[model samples]
Target: MSYLRFDKTLMINLEESLPREILRTNKSGAYHCTTIVDCNTRKYHGLLVIPVPELDDENHVLLSSLDETVIQHGAEFNLGLHKYQGDNYSPKGHKYIREFDCEKIPITTYRVGGVILTKEKIFVHYENRILIKYTLVDAHSATTLRFRPLLAFRSVRQYTHENPHANREYQEVENGIKTCMYPGYPELFMQLNKKNEFHFEPYWYKGIEYTKEQERGYDSNEDLYVPGYFEVNIKKGESIIFSAGISEASTNDMFEKFEEQAARRTPRDSFFNCLKNSAHQFHNKQGGKHYLLAGYPWFKCRARDMFVSLPGLTLAVDEVEEFESVMETAQEAIENYINNRPLNCKIYEIEDPDVLLWAIWAIQQYANATSAEQCKEKYGDLLKDIIEFIHKGKHDNLFLHDNGLLYSNGENKAITWMNATINDRPVTPRTGYIVEVNSLWYNALRFVAGMMHTGDKAESIFADSLDELAKTTAQSFIDVFLNEHGYLLDYVNGQPSDWAVRPNMIFTVAFEYSPLKPEQKKRILDITTRELLTPKGLRSLSPKSIGYNPNYVGPQILRDCAYHQGTAWPWLMGFYMEAYLRIYKTSGVSFIERQLIGFEEEMRKHCISSIPELFDGNPPFKGRGAVSFAMNVALILHVLKQLNKYY
Candidate 1:
């Protein structure tokens, strides 16, 4: 039995199948996402979602969905299902689905009377094209299939309505018709591999309800334009390919292109294999430069998330060349930050100082994987420049204090990853010498100093000076943040330490260079395990705290209030596992493996073969936030590799 397949029982259950989603992406910033049953439940769901440089830098839904109908013996069987308003389902085609398998490409088998048809889909790598192959498995008579293209040429963030600005015109190109509903957007080309006739009938499909958006308390209804349909006739044992993309050239060699891209993909036979493939999806190219995307369906490549997710997504997977390229891009971004240049921050924003600190940790991982000499040879100047800049206090209010600790006045802003806001106000307002920032500061200094001291080309490149600075910072961290409850304090200023129980304390014990003692590490781990540990991930805040919000529900304001208050974050599991192994040594393998079983099951639950961004901190931790969260996927692969080292 395939772990990623749904049987007839589950496929026919609309309530169950329609909620589970699947996502496919090409590294060129194009994605295909929708329900398991081919029903779009969210506004973000689309068949050909690609970035239009002419518009904003975000993705626009060019081709929303394709409705296919199989006609046999004067009977029309609509194989396209959609949920309308008032819980009404149009065509209700899921009832005919016999099986759904996501092990490879998304393949759905349908049985209409004695006819058996299979639909397989894959998004081309490094291209904005989606190829869908439909095969007539077994049929006694000839069948005709009609496909209607649903076009929503608008930004994914907004809903499109019936408007006069929509151009109901098209041009024929290579046995297909190209059309653009809005001006300045790329024209969408819809074509078939073989010869087919395009029916020129334009109409509006209105009142399509995005249930997921409505549940999140947003406008959910939208209107899509159906330009026309493609008609193709097929016999038994024959197959046809449907191509949708921005460039008409992609329509050529449709079958061969599909086969070529399929061969290039990493194997997806197991949980780790699936995660490995998903990790590659995060490495995207924007404007001729390679960068790691933070998450899919929404997020861009920001500095903090890119650095935080870099090592796991690249180096941990043994992708050295790509890792080097991503590091180069990050180094350039750092240079842009250091010079105080007004970058196109909309593309790759740099706000958090922790991201710069995380670069040291990522470099340390690279050094451990390859060699310290290799790191210095590749990024010696970049590493030295970052350290020098930090020492001189050139960025983000991060300056070395008189007490030998790195201090950032986090006042009136949420600088770190706990940056969730409601009505322009921070939720977890950590506005002092935060615990995690100082921990990262000490670790960054020590890692750089250790590398510089032992590096082959090292001739005392401020080696002793950085070591002394790291020592002072580590001592000050222990003296200031070590709370009476055994775990490190959340933050501190001149007054008493804010002893809030948060998962940020895990980093103090997780990093290679830690300030805590062996007993202190154990106490921190035990406290986190009792209060913050959940099946999905470590909670951002402990439930025992009065500030904890159990439910990550309701509208944007309510959701942001709970986003970091007590919501469980799957990416934090990487640090939690690292801390576990650091304190318990190899004896902790069994405990770590037990906690990972939930995530393995989670791969098949919410987003097939991937992890979501956040889950509810309370019981039955349902996956929330963005569906195919990149950092969560990267950290899962990272932890699995770490576990493999011990087992």
Candidate 2:
């Protein structure tokens, strides 16, 4: 049995299946996302969603869905599911699904009276195409299949309604037809491997509702355009491949293309492999530059996310070349930022105060994965430049004080990653001598000092100066951040120090070089484990802290308010586990391994084989936010790597 298989009992239940979404992405920023039972609960769900540079930077949903009908003996069973208004589901096709499994690719089995059919779907890598192969497993009599394509030519951020400006005309192609609903949009080419008949019947399917959107306090209802259906006959053992893409493909080679793509997939047959497969989906290649997307359903190439996730997503999986390729692009962005020139790459927020610090840490991880020598040979200059850039007071917000600690001005803007905004103002504004930022700063200084202390005389002299600066920074870090309560303060501005217990202090113990004493580190970890640790991860703020909201739900403002207050973020678990193992060594391995049980169960939960952005801080700890998050997945992989070292 497959590790991610769903039986009929779960597949037929709307409540159980609708929340379980499946996502498939091509390396070129195209994806196919929907529920396990083929129902689109969100406007972001689609059969072919791709990025169109001419239209905008956002992804557009071209083919919303494909409704399939099985016909025999003049009886038709429409096997497509869509939620309408008033909690109504048209056709209710999920009742016919016997099983759904996605070990290698998404495969669905359907049983209707005397016929058994199997549907397998795959997204072609590095291309804007989706291929679905339908096989007739067992049939007593001849059967015919009908396919109707529902089109939504709009950005994922917006919905489309019935408009008179839509072009209902289509051009006939080989065993298919191509149509463009708008002028700037690319024409959608939907073709079948075998000969089929297309009937020109353009109609509008109105009032299709997305429950996920409504629950999030957004507009939910939209209309989809259907441009007729295609009918094709099938034999008992015959298989037909359907292709949907931005460009036309050869009808004769569709079967071969599908097989080639399927062969490249890594089977999600186990917990580790599931994460490994999901990690590869975040790779986006555009304009000869490689980038790591922050998440699926809605996110882009954010600089902080890329640096934080690069090592675990690549080196942990033993993909050394990919790590170098992505870093090459990031290196360019860092250089451009320092030189005061426009970044030619696709990365966003390169000027964030902590991004450069995270970049140095990413290179440090590369050193840990391979060797310090190899890392220095490749990225030594970049590391030196980053340290020099910050030391010379070149950054906009990050200022080096006389105390040797870096301070950031987050009073106006959300400078750090805890950044949640409302009405263009920060909600949890952490300013001046933040815990993680200074911890990262100290680690970077010490690391560069070690890397540059080798043979060159000038480099050795620079390393000595860095050592002196690190010592001063360490003394000030203990003085300003560590309070009398045995736990570190979150941040220290002009006002009374914010002594809230947060996951930010975990970095002090997790880094290889730390400013805190061993006992001081132990006291912080004890406080963290007691107050902020959850089965999912570490909470942003302790429950005992005032203004703590444990759940992330309701409208936009409410969700934003609770986003970082007390929500548990899985990415923090990586640092927490590292601190535990570093302090307790082999004695803590068993305890840390058992802590991962909750995350293992999540592999079969929301967004199968992937990790979500966060979970509620309260009981049940249900997943919320983006379905598949890059940093969450990557850090978990890093933890797994650390565990293997113990064995």
Candidate 3:
């Protein structure tokens, strides 16, 4: 039995299966997602979702789902499940599911009377295609399968109503037919591995309700266009494959290509292997450079996410080439900005000073993982170039203060990672001399200085002024940020320090180059462990803080207000583990290892085989936010490897 297998007892029960969703992504930024029971409960769920760069760099759901029916001896059974208006389920196919498993791919077994059929699904790694193969496991006589293609042909974020503009005609392709619903979208090719007859009976399936979207207070109901159905006959032990994609060429060697791609996949024998596989999903080629998608389903590439997640997502996994490529991409973006050229890369709408610092820190991590000399040989000049940009202040409002802290002022924008704003107002509003920014600043300066210090007088000349600045920053950081309260302040403006007990202080100790002393690191961890640390991750704010929101719920405005207030972000767990280990040494290894086990257990709960973006701060710390969050998975793998280094 596969690790993520579910029997008919659970599959037949919609309550248990509806909430559990499955995801399959390709290297080309296409994905297949839906609930475990082959039903789409969310608008983000789709059978063929691909990126359309010309359509504003967002994923478009060309084909929502493909419903199948089994016909035998003049009897027909629909194996498709859809929720219509009035909370009714049509063609409740999930009731016939004998078994379901998601070890590597999603496989569902169905037994209807004397006929038993097994269906398996896989998405092509480097192409925009989905292949579903059905085999006649057992049968008394000849049986037939009918496939009805449901096309949404709209942005995943939007819904489609019954429109006259949709083309009702389809052109014959190699093994099947291709049809284009919208003029701007690509033509969707619905082909088969074997030649079959195409019956064009176009109709609209209206009032298809998306419960998740409704719960989020958005337009939940949509109308889907079913162009036609494909019918084919099969005997016992015979299998048939169905393909769908933007191009007819994607169907070439469908089965053989899927097998070859599946063979190259990393084994999901353990939690770590699953995470390693998930790390690969975030990488996509865009703008002529390798980029990492922040998360699955929703998030696109962002500068902060790229830099913060680079070390864990690449270097920790021994993906040296990927690490270098990402760094080069970041450097190219900075150069584009320096030369006043079109950015054309992943640049956050609000430029983050800490993101620039994290780039330096990520390179330092790569140098630690590999050899410093090797890092210098490849990224030496690139690091200098980035440092030069930071010093030159290419980013808006970012400047090095006389006190050695990086300062920026913005009333309505979030400058740091606590960068969630609602209705034109910054939530956290960490505008000036944020705690984490300064911490990263000191670390970056010292780290790059250490890298440059490896050479002679001429080569090491850059380290002289940087070293002095880092020294000044460390002293000023302790004076301005540290206090008798036993924890570092979250941020400091012209007035008194905002001494909210936040997890941002942990980075000051967790980093390889720390500004705080040994005792200070211990004190910071003490407060962090007592207040912010949860079983799943680190809380954004302590419960003792004034504006702590334990539960992240309600409308967009409510959720945005609580985004960084007290949301327990799984990515922060990495820094917490690092800080705990740095202070307690080997004695803390088991503690972190045990905590990692909790995260592994979480993979079984939400977004099976992946980590979530955030959880609630209070008890029953339920996983909320994005389902397949990339940074959370990357950080967990990176920090676990870091802990293992001690042993």
Candidate 4:
């Protein structure tokens, strides 16, 4: 899920490299320290430790992924705002500055406090002023884990860049640099002495390097990483300020201006808490979740992704009644898509098909949380239309399948984002029956059938049909999807479908409205945990999978191949947690509880910021790809809500 970086964009923080943080294991065996850093701030947002850690001064050292391990030091931004987008430019403002220092910061719990709850505070040991916040939020409350992780600053300095090409588009007939200011810590800052420094620095993943002497030197066209250095003195009993604004040349000005702007703008926690509370209310009363973050799909202007996250974000925060309203929104979106094709006649965005399944999966959650009468009465027409649309295949109904799986390609093929591609190449390039889709279809049918039964239509027939469909699904599609290997195929209908273990089955296992039996659910959990589970979350595909991409790099084909190949997606952690809960409720909670107790701490540790976008599966592993999705945030809120169960 996305966290607020100093840049102000809700993006992923894929910069955790601390072995302990990235390893997902705490110093002691019992707790897993899920520590996240705001890659930009280089400050600890919060942390999760299993069995809890006995906080010592050492525990307070903010760990960084990019900090050269040899140097063992950390860095922070001096944005006039105290935040940074990348090390290169001002956040959305796109303006740039060369310096600032870590000084006073503001913070408080968001609820009773102003829109931004955190107020400035000072610490003893480090003597660095930083912001601190304590919150129940939505996710972790279900479990009895108290988060007391602290964040502080060690040191940070600034270097300026002379980029004449700052705003100029590379492909837009651009020549000569479009100059703009950028604050960065390059080798030039690094002291020749290695002892008092962090060995590592932020290399522009795809950046041009420069030398202080060569601001307009002969090496003008060449991009180089000018070495830089600085120091952070986190002496014992010290703290650093976590400023509300960024680290621009004028920290005080940015703070004073943004503090007022922040005051005028929508409150940070309000936006977050609104999404959470609204979702929680819906889940509690409606019994289902609005899977989409913002709005829903199809006609009437309600989009697909928007509606699904409604419950997860809205309800999880506090809006209980909106659950039904969101479900209503989903109804309208789905019905319009089926009957009218407003979203897409084929529902294909580029060359992928997962969005459709994701939308359907959302509806399943919506139905589960709402009353049969409410769902049927409000969304009866919408449900029928969606079902009819799924049934009505392309090419004038000539491409219908008995089992109900969508095929973007001619055959019963699979091509979702996970298996999608572009430029005649697959981002995922999946070709065959996949696992998540069919499972979603089966779940959707049962939900619609049950809803139909509740309607004034012929109930008995729909119920029996649903039962038959369930039986058929249990016997055929399941076996077809899952193989003798015990691992589910990334896709079927191929000579040997890729037997990649992923978080695909979490939905079927997690959702109360799934089509799996007790034994099958147990198996799904076992496979998922063994292959996909990581301290951060579930990886897109197991490293053991042949197709897994170990590194994040290259062109569209290369990147797309790596997209779902072996990326560890933290967002899936919520689903994995939910599925684990479901399995425990049925069987005893032994294995699941064991996993959860350990995972509770693991979830929090080493996550740069609440969550990093993705991480390398290898040790001393570092996070990569830095854009967080709302669902990941929603998942955290949901998990937190579940934590309240213990209380």
Model 3 score (lDDT) = 0.84
Kindly provide the TM-score of model 3 when superposed on the true structure, using C-alpha atoms.
Answer: 0.97
Q: Candidates ranked by lDDT, best first?
A: 2, 1, 3, 4
What are the per-residue Cα lDDT tens digits for candidate 4 across 1-647?
A: 21222321211222321211211211121111221221222222112111112332122222111121011122222211112223342221111211111112212222211111122221211111122222223221111111111111111111223344322121101111111112221100111111122222323312222221122122311221212223333222222222211111223232343344334322223233323322221121112323232210011112433433554665555554655555554554455544544632111231234444455555555555555675566556666655655565522322235654533452333245354355555555555565666666677777777767654556657566766766666556666766676545656664756666777777777665666677877887888878787655677878777777755554445555677877766557777777776666435334434543422342323332223446665453445542224455566666655555544
The numbered model that scores best in TM-score is 2
Best by lDDT: 2
> Poorest 10 consecutive residues of model 2 by lDDT?
493-502
Clashes of 2: 0
lDDT of 2 by residue, 1-647 (tens): 77989999999999999999999999888999999999999999999999999988999999999999999998999999999999999989899999999999999999999899999999999989999999999999989999999999999999999999999999999999999999999999999999999998999999999998998999999999999999999999999999999899999889889899899899998888999998999999999999999999999999999999999899989999999999999998899999899999889988999999999999999999999889999999999999999999999999999999999998878988888999988998999999999999999999999999984999999999999999999999999999999888888986987877888999999998999999999999999999999999999999999889989999999999999999999999888998999999999999999988889999988999999999999999999989999999999899899899999
lDDT of 1 by residue, 1-647 (tens): 87688999998898788779999998878899999999999888999999988888888999999999999988999989887889999988998999998887789999999899999998988888899999999998879999998999989999999999899999988868888887899888888888888898889999999988988999999999998889989989998999998889545588788788767766567888788877888878777688888887898887778877888888778888888888877777777778876554343547576777878778888888789889878777777888888888887678778777877776677788999876676777786688888888888788777778865445366777888887788788889888777888888877765667999999888988887888988999899999999989999999888789968888988898899999999889888998898778799999988988988888678888888889999888988988878778877777887887886
Clashes of 3: 0
RMSD of each: 1.5, 0.7, 1.6, 16.0
Superposition error at 51 for model 2 (Å): 0.3
Runs of candidate 4 with Cα error greater than 4 angstroms are: 1-308, 321-333, 341-357, 367-370, 394-400, 403-414, 419-424, 459-463, 553-558, 586-609, 643-647
Model 1 clash pairs are none
Q: Which residue ranges in model 2 land beyond 4 Å of their true spot?
A: none
Candidates 2 and 4 compared by TM-score, better number: 2
Which residue pairs collide, candidate 2? Answer: none
Candidate 3: the clashing residue pairs are none
